[model samples]
Target chain A: MKTIQKQAQALLCNSLLASAVAVIFATSALADELNYSNKLLLTGGVSQVEGAAGGGLTPWAVIGGYGTNNEVGGSVHYTYVKTGDYKLDTYGFTIGLFDRVEFSVAEQSFDLGKLRNKVTAGLGADVFGRNQLTQTIVGLKVRVAGEAILDADTWMPQIAVGLQYKDNDETDFIKSAVIGAKSDHGTDVYVSATKLLLAQNLLLNGTLRLTKANQFGLLGFGGDKHDSYQPMLELSAAYLLRKDLAIGAEYRMKPDNLRSPANDLLFGGANVVDLKEDDAFDVFIAYAPTKNISLTAAYVNLGNIATVKAVGADYGNQEGVYLSAQIGF
Target chain B: MNINIKAATAALLATATFLMAQPAIAEVYAQNPNLGNTPMEGTATFEAFGGKEGLVKIMDDFMIGLVADPRTKPFFDNNKQTFIKAMLVEQMCELMNGGCKYPGRDMKASHANMKVNREGFNALVEQFQFAMDKHNVPFSAQNKLLAKLAPMYREIETTTGDAVPPVFPKAE
Candidate 1:
């Protein structure tokens, strides 16, 4: 029996050797080259996806992050957006170590116009001046069951699940007794999945978030008073208009917890076309100038501030446009 | 009109010359039995591919590219140009056309001295493609040539301590 076992082991080793030899011999006979495709012909050189900023993913832009070959990459972003007299300066960054892991950090500083503005006549320019808010997230993504690489000439898209931990910087509005919260910092749990159904032609992605944080950091309020399981969702669809160009639209939802002179749901979970709803729509275009860089621009219609509704919900509309540039090596 | 025997023989000779100049016919993969076959040279392989001169032309172009690619610029710059080119030409030709004998070193022996990795090999292959495109070679002819060079990686990679991938390691 021992001799038989030894013989089996030897046979296995010899078989492996033969297979290796066969592969080498076959390669020698066939002609292959040295370029990415020349060597094994798999695609390489990942670039940024330039486009608009949705409440869901814009923060990921401030830092440098990108998507890798069915893996992970990161990008650093500087963005500018204008809503009426409000000029928003946003800094964003996100990184995906592998396709299964992600992390993001970002900040937004709002420069609310002069003192005489009707909206701020009560607080006066001194009390209602410009403020900065920073948000950072650390996340772990996993492909419990999915493929990141597309099969040759087929449409079996890959899928993955991710959880993001978020930190927010609070402002005096919440610290000054408007909302009753021990702390402004909170965590957001998100599970997202994406698919590239058409060999770079089309992509469909969406995310669901359960969080205690209030607002996207626009108001003085922080997380829910009693740790309410606030819900946030983002749906985005992208299509390759050209071999290296893409255009997409995103619908993002946020939390409503602005409790200053408290009305109903304070934060107003969303903004759109100045319509005062709980969501916003963003349209963006990404231009891949090269294999290593991309430029994106978008238009956003974030509705009315729900708080103004208490004084009669008819506080006119505020529209804005956002632009960003992305670089990858 | 008078029938001229000399003119008739001259016509036949011209027709024969034209037939000899024609390229090989495209083979049906199912019937050829060479499909998926490891690129090995046989007496029949020689006749099917063009004669010695044709096979040599392919090698000549392939070598010129190997030496010219900027990516592989280091390969030639670092090695003795004449020695490398001569051996490459010999191995490639004899292994394909079978008209000549392959008398070069084994894959491992030839590359043993060079710590060539996947990246290095890729650089060389790119140059070959640039050379082929410049020469306006057809894809079919290129395939016929590749079959013979594909098998060297096993021995070559083993000797160099490079990662052994099923195909060339271009993407990581």
Candidate 2:
């Protein structure tokens, strides 16, 4: 617990430092009163879950923030999601430098709800249900090829490669008992292709990720059944209703690496629990009232999470609402 | 319980139907009024801008804006604004299929001696956008015209003599 708190504090300090630097840059640019125009409006997508620029669930090729090709821009975002059995809150900051590179840091807190108490009682351990599980993620992305807005009429799509390193706070719980994960830290590497059809007001993104993260690192990384890297696909499609408003859908494939053990050592054989991971999908609406602020709302479906069939406590298909608010220059 | 499920299914279907119908409705409302019932391409763009008279006005206003800009004023110092304006009008008319001929020199030949840089060209484009906005040209119409002209950048931007080599070879 102390380690987790320290890590969280470190993350907060780093975020503040990054913000201070961005403010200094912005102040200097303002002092000059330069008309630094670069990219088109709304070409930079909203911040993603991990603080990268993209849709809510998946990262896209475009960098985050409003910075044109010659200016520096940064954004801070807060996101919340509530489901039948779990709740997740994420807060982060992302910076785009000259529209070329993006750097982000986000802290996620996952609340396990009644399942925490059930797991605690079943395992007779004080660790479960004691506190919310937290994870800190640091991400970096670089635009490699093509341009979303400039190449709108061409067959080529903008492409970017990124990596997110995640560190979960609860190391012991993840290693020995829950899902038998090998480590509390994992890194996800992904390549994303994005295209903007400006004339039709349509945007499309496809991402291929190599990861072993379970529930986005909230449940830790790499299960006993499969610890090696696995490939996953995420796709997003959005239609701009207007220059400032967009409606989109995202689908993300999750890895199902947790298999039921032959005999349970933690729980009695009669009350053995198995881990099940399923793909997630969402339909979202994002509205940017101004260039500096945006609000996003979505209906999300995160399928069966940490279900125990023997206990008759299937969390079922987790469906709920997601909301995010972002402000940037 | 059965009736409840039936009602839920009916409601879901209705919502889906309504959501699916939204795009078609939005398309109708989002249509550009300035298009004037013409297809959004080719000669129709010229027609939408009111043909020759409209082209003349746009060129006149654009030249005025360009001259007012300090960054671009130096480029136009040697030429008469009237002649420049007429040539631009002819070029735009020919590009938009206005049934007018561009009697002036080609883009590369005319710009070869100017040594125009990217920033200078961008300034001109900004001025053009301002002129179109001043004339109340619709945003979509402006973009359509600009898209057609954007390909000319390769020919017009010839800074540092990289685009066209000298006719006489340098002595070794």
Candidate 3:
């Protein structure tokens, strides 16, 4: 546990240092006459959960930053979500170069709330006092084909490939006891196709991810039951009410690795808190008053979060509010 | 379970209602009050732009902007600004179905001798967009007009040769 904490801290520090260097390099290369060229305002999309440019939960083909083909741009975002039993906060910075490649670093902290006390009491020790699980993710996205805004009239959708490396801080609890995860770290690869129907004022995106991440690596990675890599699908559709305001919905399928252990060997059978992963969806509204800043609010349904029973109900159908603020150049 | 179904039904109904109301909402917002007129396509947009008078002003501003831009200035060099502006106004009037017949030369024939490249054409478009912005033309209106004019790219650009001239003369 101590070793994992030290490694997580080191990784966070390194990510911060790298991001600072990148910012300095990008600022130095900026020109005086900043122009967006053929890019439409706010078509670059906002940062997603793992800090890639996309919808709230799924990554899209559009790069995160405001940079056009001729210039460099970057953005910083903070996201917050609160459910009945857990609270999640994520903050990140992403930089896009020539609208071709994007790089990002994000940190997510999940608070288990009162479940921490219950779990510790059940364990007959202060074992789960450090219930705040922290995960650091570094991501890269490269545009491979088409253009989202310029080719709005065409049938071709913009496509991009992305990779995210996630590292979790809590290692011991994930390894053998709770979820039986094999590792504390994993890599996720995804390809996203996004299209903008400018004439109809609609946007659609689909993403396929190859991953073995459990609960997006918050619970752990590669569990004993279903540890192999699996392909996941994420879909998003949005309607632009105006050039600046958009309402959308996103559906993301999760990997169900926890199949309920045979005996009550792990953590009591009925009380064992099943890790039944379920699909999640959200209805979101994004408003961009300017080309440089955007505010997004969403009603999210993250089904069956950490299986913690609360208020005479399991943590199934976990409904929550998601809010995010993004500022870019 | 009953409450869940009721809540779900209510949400669906609200979504359906909002979707049905969108077209009317779009109609209300499309008529920008700041522009002092609704910018519709076809004859309505032409009349809203003040028919011949507004077109002449737009052409004048567009010509001024073109002449001032270094990237597009060479294309207009040696040409009389008033003559070009008059021809453009006529072309725009015809394109907008403004009940005006354009007596100017066709786009392909006029630009074939000039050997206008894509960059030059794009620069001119940029200048036109700048002029429209200066005139406080609504964005939707500008795009409506631009969509009609955009098809002329193939006719106006690169009719003779593929070689593109540099904006500035090369020094010895």
Candidate 4:
């Protein structure tokens, strides 16, 4: 059984690795004759959080300076988020078409609690089990409104709609089987709003998200939201640190639904334990040395699960820091 | 003082004449049979910039000062999770390098709606000049760079209701 789990994990990892190659092929096949801006790539704007206290997404913010170049382009980016023992790492390539549409393929690996792994079935131990989760994701974003890179006037928000398709895989043998779904797929739809407030040399940003992925949980195992709605709010403010640089902070909130439906088995319904968590806070700092590349670092603090600790595992989840780098073609 | 003024005028005329001669040299260099023909020799890169290695340090130092500048302070002072730094570094570096198509929007399209006046524009340019100076960029190179970037003003500045580049040229 242990060997079987190892083999399954290997196959998934291999497939995920291959998708990087596939993304490149898809891009080439679609548009063979396009010379996009070889110009400097632009990084994330001022707003650090989702909902802006002052403004929303502007046209310039949506395309990251690409929209101004009047062409299509692509980029390779890597992001790493760490909280004590918890880490989420992503590597992906994003392509923009005439600054109208953007497509991306990303691979995410999450290590929960960075906890110790003990293979007791006499298999000794490998770096296999700090409870890592890997996901293959494809996302599409469309710029929907507004003009002007900076609005000295009232906040004219630039809005975009995006969709992300996520596929998840787990490693542990016992957990995978109990998950009832070793592999699962989820779709997320999101709307983002950004604005650059020129008066204060400040930028305000925010986003609205609706998803049913059970909070990016284990082995793609998400609780049935019963089509329930979860609302997340993020507010960020960026002050031009200099002519070419900006630093900002963000405050965000997540869903609060983590528990099993009582007596669903006795009631004769398909039974699945629902484990989710309360809202958490994440604050980050970003730096753009130029307009072409950007570096972001942040710390995330997730609140404790009052009910979960009563069950079995001690998530002891505290906080972690992350550094992310982005490039635009 | 009168003698010094006369001397400076003569020197200025000489400089103008020298600058005029350079374009001719560039043309002759293009036709020269001695040196292997390079298409670039036909035109004057020197006319736009001091030379090939001009913009590098100027660009770098401008950004370095930008990150340290207090006038532009609010943007990144409190950042913890954002990666704007690396982006700007690469972008500015690319801009300094010749002919890289900047993927960003037009200065006007990006800044038009933002209403930057002469004062704001002057402040921004001052920062740029400081950065270039700190990096030891030559005066000619600085002039050339400014010439190339001057037109971007249409995108970021207003003339009628707004203002132009020289916020307040000292009264002679």
Error of 2 at A28 (Å): 9.8
lDDT of prediction 2: 0.71
Per-candidate TM equals: 0.50, 0.72, 0.71, 0.52
- Residue B142 in model 4: lDDT: 47
Off by over 4 Å in 1: A1-73, A98-100, A113-120, A123-130, A134-149, A152-156, A175-183, A220-227, A262-277, A306-317, B1-172
For residues A156-181, write the lDDT of model 4, one tens digit per residue: 55557776677665534213322333
Query: Each prediction's DockQ?
Result: 0.02, 0.06, 0.07, 0.02
lDDT of each: 0.44, 0.71, 0.70, 0.45
Model 1 clash tally, residue pairs: 58
Assess the local accuracy of residue B78 in candidate 3 as a C-alpha lDDT between 0 and 100.
Answer: 41
What tens digits encode model 1's per-residue C-alpha lDDT throughout B6-61? 54345445433432443222323232222211234454544444556544565566
Candidate 4 chain A, run of 10 with poorest lDDT = A50-59
State how far residue A37 of model 4 sits from its true place (Å). Answer: 6.7
- Candidate 1 or 4, higher lDDT? 4
Return the lDDT, model 3, position A303.
Answer: 82
Native-vs-model 1 lDDT? 0.44
Runs of candidate 3 with Cα error greater than 4 angstroms are A1-38, A121-124, A259-263, A266-271, A310-313, B1-172
Query: Candidate 2, residues A82-159: lDDT per residue as tens digits?
Result: 988889999888888877899888889888857877656655665464458878898999998766655433546777
- Candidate 4 structure, TM-score to reference: 0.52
Worst lDDT 10-window in candidate 3 chain B: B22-31
Show where candidate 4 strays beyond 4 Å. Answer: A1-61, A64-69, A113-130, A171-183, A217-229, A257-274, A304-313, B1-172
Candidate 4: clashing residue pairs, number? 69
Q: What's each prediction's clash count?
A: 58, 0, 0, 69
